[model samples]
Target: MNAIELSHVSTAKPVLLGDSLTELEVMRDVSLSVPEGEILALIGPSGSGKSTLLRMINRMEDPTSGRIFLFGSDIANLDVKELRRRVGMVSQTPALLPGDVADNIAYGPNLRGEPCNPGDYLEHVGLERELLRRPASALSVGQQQRMCIARALANHPDVLLLDEPTSALDRTASRNIVELILRLNEKLGLTVIIVTHVMEHAQALATRVAMLVGGSLIEQGPAVDFFESPATETGRKFLRGELAEDGR
Candidate 1:
């Protein structure tokens, strides 16, 4: 069964100046399902609405029309805070609080009324327990990113949303994050959706690939099929580096 489902999802832009004013449609009649216990990678150009789609999944942005179901329940009717707690997000720039590492990692757990134990979570994310005493802002970018993951894990979430989680890291650090993501999935059976502009990273980690163009899904299927036999001309161009010049 699908863990998440979007039915004829469409998000429109709001009028700014006048009631008749129209904005470009961000997503149009989109429908898809993500199964439990799998990693889905979303790849697209800058204005393709990939981020918007992810945001809608977490209810950060509501859909203009249609419905979304988490498991079997309608997500639009769920409690926002409770739903967000179940679906954790990690952005490219790690947003750490002005506190020690332990505090940062403990924030989510505390908010959820769960036990805040930083040592175990930090270790789970492959960090030393001793680093818990260091200020969150003192860590290097890579370490900060790992701490962000640890913080998310502290919530014991069923799903994780990662947006270019390795974009700021060096190659070594990027590999480490990817490895850690895989390990976390194996250990916790987390359903993960990672959005990245980097094709190589998507190729390396995605169980399934969904490529978007002009705010619509161009191709979506097994990772191998999307990479080997892209359905749309836009997807084909992207794979051949013809569309890499776009600012995405």
Candidate 2:
């Protein structure tokens, strides 16, 4: 089953007012899909709407004119609250709640009235059980990031959306998190969609890579192919590091 399916998805067009103040058009006719249990990376330069696309997938933002399906159901027609519960997201800066680790991890399940064992999730993320009582702010950056991931997993989400999850981490920490994500995908069959500016990181974690530029999807294919044979000029330039100063 396809975990996510999008067809002709588009954001709102800019509306010009009487005074000629123009609204910015963020996303174009964006469309993509990820099969169940596959890890796909959404790659692009900053402001390319990769994050916007991720948000749309989980209904954090509604598309102006498009359809999104998750787990075989049209997300537009599903209950907003329930749909979110099944799709978890983690961003670059770990948004750990102001509470102990256990409480933070259990927050989602608690809200849903679902039975939760924060310890189980912590273990799944390779954290110690004793850290449950630690305050979220007390852990090192890497540890805190892992805690955030564990918190997301506490809900047993079917699809996980990650947005530049390792941007702030050191090389070692970033590697660890990447390995953990791969392990989670392999062991639990989690369908993961990651948005990343770092091409190397995307290559390391993704089974497939989708490149976006100027709010357009340039190309998407297996990880190896995306790196070796980018189909679009934008992708080729990006892979060659020709757009480094421009942040592409």
Candidate 3:
């Protein structure tokens, strides 16, 4: 079963409002499907709409045209709260609650009147159970990110969306998070979609890769094929590191 899908999804934001509105299309004809238990990395220069497209998944933003499906259901029709729970998201930087580690992890479940143990998810994210009581602010950047992951998992999500999850981590922390992501995909069968600017990190974790630029999908394919022998010049440039993020 497909965990998530976007069919000709397009998003436009109003740039000018007057007698006639001028809108900037941030994403256009973006169609992709994330298979169950697979990892898809979305890579692109900045302002290419990578983050815009990611936000569309849980309805943090909506498409002006086309459709987005989550686990075979139209996300637009699903309850916003429930849709987010089923498809969790973590951003580039950790956003922990103003409390202890356990409180951060249990925040989601507590909202739904469910019980959760910080230990159950800590190990999954390479965190120690003993740190459960530490104040969120006291933990290292990496530990904070893991706490964010644990919090997302507390919701029992089927799909996990990460946007540049390791961009702020040290080399070692980044690698550890990558390993944790793989373990989650394997053990929990979670469908993972990550938006990242770092090509090496994407190469390490993604089964398939999707490239977006100027609000449009340039190409997508197996990671090896996309990186080694790109079909488009733009893609080739991107892979060769000639194109910096932001397409400059």
Which ten contiguous residues of candidate 2 have the minimum total lDDT? 239-248
Candidate 1's TM-score reads 0.93
For residues 123-218, write the lDDT of model 2, one tens digit per residue.
999999999999999999899889988988988889999988899899999999999999999999999999887788888888888877776778
lDDT of each: 0.87, 0.87, 0.90
Clashing pairs in 2: none
Any runs in candidate 1 off by more than 4 Å, and if so which?
15-22, 244-248
lDDT of 1 by residue, 69-88 (tens): 88878988899988888888
Candidate 2 ranges with C-alpha deviation above 4 Å: 13-21, 244-248
Q: Mind sharing the TM-score for model 3?
A: 0.94
Best by lDDT: 3
Poorly placed runs, candidate 3 (over 4 Å): 15-22, 244-248
Q: Estimate each model's TM-score.
A: 0.93, 0.93, 0.94
